[model samples]
Target: MKTIIKYMLLCLLAVNTVTAQQNSQSINLSNAEVTPYEIELTQNKTTHILFPSSIEYVDLGSSEIIANKVEATSNVLRLKTVKEDISPTNFTVITNDGKYFSFNVSYKGQPIQLSYDLTKFEKQKSKKQSEVLFKDLGSISPSLVDLLMKAIIKKNKKELNIKSKTYGVEAWLKSIYIQDGKLYFHISISNKSNLPYEVDYISFKIKDRRTTKRTTIQEVSLKPIRSYITSQKINSHSKQDTVFMLDQFTLSDKQVLSIEVNEKTGVRSQVLKLRSSEILKLRRVELLKL
Candidate 1:
């Protein structure tokens, strides 16, 4: 009887050794390193997680569902999963990440959970600033010819001249210079009207007439000038204006550039054309060199 008992004990030890080896192999297979952002699906549900580098999916069958829910608390991302429901045939869980995971109601008995890591698909940082670039045209100024193109469709030259002579708009060449290895511009506008008016839109157009090709860097939209009366007794006129600033530009020699501003629904606009020499002159003036 003692011999039989000893034999039974030896048999149990052998069984335990085999079970331990199988468990170790299973762990090594499931935890293989995978590429970032790559996904692995098992049983039509995301049972194992892997990145782009992962070679295979690890399956955790229904019996192992209880132990399948795991959390990753790495600095890259914090993840959590919980079992929502469990049945004899299947199991379900919900995962929380940047967004909540969705669940289906149709699979009431065989619900599946999904989770993902986004660190692999993160966008790289950009060095460029958010800006718009206009074309490069040599020194150009607002000409009466260009202004006529922006005039109200039906307004005649007589009416326009009368308006300009009576309530003429003030004009000025603000300045031009270079900054951050690029050119910069600032243009200001003022409203000298007695009545309040609304400006709908503004546009800038550049006409490049240069012997060499020039690269235009940036353009800015200016707000329309609006003004209204503050009081009746004073009967004082109020004025409002807009200012535009351009940056990062390179101009070629002998370029003639035209910058035009137009107001939407208003029969008026301001245009500026400057040549390379004129731009240099303005820069010098700004620097107080001449």
Candidate 2:
């Protein structure tokens, strides 16, 4: 009976050794050594963490805290502790650009800072992406979209002749590009007047082809998802270039697309009417590099 007990003990020791070895091997094999950022949370106030890209997912290690992405914004996360004197916890955030972020959170009566902008940190800048598609981009890689946008700006080709000229200010549609269910509009504004053309705003909308004085005009607005423009002021005898990205769409008959640019605090507004035929003139996106 004593020999049998000794044999059982030896078997158990061997099993424990194997399990420990497996665990050590798994821990050592890593893609990257990601150090978790330490942050303190409190119940009295909320903490905000700003990411470079839209947040895709968030997971908390414990229920001691509540966290969520801020409404009406894609890149800001709001967090707060549930109660006072809670135990420490950890959380993970995955962003649309396929970057992973880890945080170790501890409760503090008063946190030193409430807002953290990760975008400003050089270490937090967007690098290589993981294999994930952005929801807004619809199965398209966010990195690819960014690369294409940069490529378009670098190319800067004036391939289209569509324009609306008035008030000594001319707005031209330099190009229209299509890729991955998106439309890229390259535009240029030339101001020939002696005064600078302060652009108030630009609008792309679909409206009825003909509106009667007695009837209400039906309209639909098309807001761009992103844009690449530094300034809106077109100085006298100068020009400015811009690019806008929007979801691809097709209009029906009796509907015309309008691209309107309004002057700031002025009445010089130019509208370019586009028919379905004109909008169909799309340049397929095929760039080797960004």
Candidate 3:
């Protein structure tokens, strides 16, 4: 009876091992069929590939027949081939999330696997000129950059005698500058009180003086040009400076653009105001050449 019980246990163990091996083989076959990206291109034709997200980086195995090495728009890549080559080529694109999308360019005839939406592609192309201008502004001096900052502060002081708010921390409106149809604000935050201040985040909104509800107003969001600091932890008796940029557009007299700063502790907030007059004053700044 004991020998029969041992034989039954061995049979069960062998059946389990066989099932596990079969599952492993199925998984391997499925993985073999999955690919990053695959498409065929003609020997002397142009091909464009559109990606889901904006491309952050790109790499090419060789630049022999690639007419345009790696010209990438926000979510589009343009590859042109002039002649056929001996060795194969691999093209890879790194998206914002760091995921790699690779492709192999096999020299073939017509009936390629390339498709794109022309309306969306043209819109992405329009941003190329503005993107180049933003990069050039980074090389300018902060002091010279401060001219725009001073302009914004001066507008606030002249129009409204309102001073900056000070809870445990104090914020000052430094300057407002415009470059290549983009609005930018420079500000300084100081914490001299005993309590430490943790920044929650900064937000921009346009409010209508005639209406009380802010949601009714239409405004495009603004972002920091260079991500120098997002939400810094501010210790007591310390100060820091930051800059922000908004989409280029003019506001009417009835509209007011507000920059709101929220604290993590929910104790206090500083709201900076920019009216049409202030924006117009910034337009006349020397460097802007409005």
Best by TM-score: 2
What's the CA RMSD for each of the models? 21.9, 6.8, 20.9
- Candidate 2 residue spans exceeding 4 A from truth: 1-36, 43-48, 53-83, 92-100, 109-115, 121-131, 165-169, 190-201, 210-218, 229-240, 251-255, 262-266, 287-289
**What's the TM-score of every candidate structure?**
0.30, 0.65, 0.44
Q: Rate the local accuracy (lDDT) of all candidates.
A: 0.35, 0.84, 0.61
Residue 130 error, candidate 1, Å: 18
lDDT of 2 by residue, 1-290 (tens): 99999999999999999999999888553656577789999999999999877798999999999998899888999999889989989999988666778899999999999999888763655443334565667876766777677777678877777888988989888778988789998888889999999989889999999878998999999998767666878889998888788999998788888999899998878888888887888788874244
Candidate 1 Cα deviation (angstroms), residue 161:
21
lDDT of 1 at 79: 22
The true-versus-predicted C-alpha distance at residue 17 of model 2, in Å, is: 22
Per-residue lDDT over 1-290 for candidate 3, one digit per residue giving the tens place of the 0 to 100 score:
99999999999999999999998787656644425445666665667766544566687766644523234346677765566542657676655323355567666656345564333533575321111112434544433444454454444322233235867667766666666555666677778888787788878777775765655756656565432353478788887666666556678898887887788876767888878887666543454321
In candidate 2, clashing pairs total 0
Local accuracy of candidate 1 as per-residue lDDT tens digits, 207-261:
4464334676443333211111122121115433233334344445645455554
How many clashes (backbone N, Cα, C below 3 Å) per candidate? Answer: 18, 0, 5
In TM-score terms, candidate 2 sits at 0.65
lDDT of 2: 0.84
Candidate 2 Cα RMSD (Å): 6.8
